[model samples]
Target: METDRQGLFRLPFKLPSSAKARSVGVYIAGALYAIGAWSFFDAAIYSRKANASSVHVTFVDWIPFICSTLGMIVVNSIEKNRLIQDAMGSGSFSGSSSMAWQARVILFLGFALLAGGISGSIVVLILKFLVKDFTSYPTLGMGVNNVVGNFCIALSCVVLWIAQNVEDEYSYSLTL
Candidate 1:
């Protein structure tokens, strides 16, 4: 005899099965990146055309966004399989410790740039706008947008990394 047991209710979530469905993460990541980029660009446009305040989005503001973008590119350009193979100690390219070390260093640089971009945006927000008397919403919003945009870009990078395995779907690795 079997008894019907009352259990905790769970939300229904149908997992996607197709490879195309899996790639949706990439699309989402791209959309996030686009939104971030558009936000920053909009800030610049406002500064150029609509801003009443003397403060404007300058090259300093662009620096963080550029760094973040470059970091994203670098981070995603690496092959995750190389790192995995090196750690496992078996693969066609795993024989050379220097290769693994190089990969690690490059990956570290990429992450460092990403972190630096976010921090730099915050620093700009504080030192440039907040510290000054530009407390008005319009002027302050520029700095705030920069910070938000960089953050979104970083988030997009994370999403993209997860979606594409740091963006290398097919790693060229040969096992021995």
Candidate 2:
């Protein structure tokens, strides 16, 4: 006799299970990251080429972008299953546990850096532009671009996380 088992409720929205879907998500993430990078570059280049004001793109403006990119790289490089296994008590103290501890520390650092990057952008926007009373669009645009680019990178990280979590679905045959 076969028994019916209780299952968790499914979401109304479904992610595609095909490998192509995964590839598409990765491509989209890359595109978003590129857009963010280009936006920052645009601001920098604009400042060099046509800036009429004293305010310019400085090293401070680049720091947030660097932090975010580094965080994304660190977060993506971790093998997620190992962490999960460690959490579930499948890890040995000498080997798996140590690795898991390292992974967790690194992961925490990555997320901290990512959050710092986004926060730093907002700080620059306020302190550099708004606080200086530079309300004019041309002078303010550099700060705006930095904020927007950091936001785009954050979104790219989200997309990549969701894409990585999606699992392949298949069916199994039952014999009576």
Question: Model 2: per-residue lDDT, tens digit, 138-173?
Answer: 889999999888888988987886677556455243
Determine which window of 10 residues in candidate 1 has minimal summed lDDT. 2-11
Candidate 1 lDDT, tens digit per residue, 33-129?
A: 9989988998999999999877989999999999999999989887765455455545344355776678778988999999999999999999999
Report how far off residue 147 is in candidate 1 (Å): 0.5
The local distance difference test score of each candidate is 0.80, 0.80
Judge candidate 1 against the unseen true structure and give its global Cα lDDT, from 0 to 1. 0.80
Candidate 2 Cα lDDT to native:
0.80
Q: Tell me the deviation in Å of residue 106 in model 2.
A: 0.9
**Please, what is the TM-score per model?**
0.80, 0.81
Clashing pairs in 1: none
Runs in model 2 deviating more than 4 A are 1-14, 89-96, 169-176
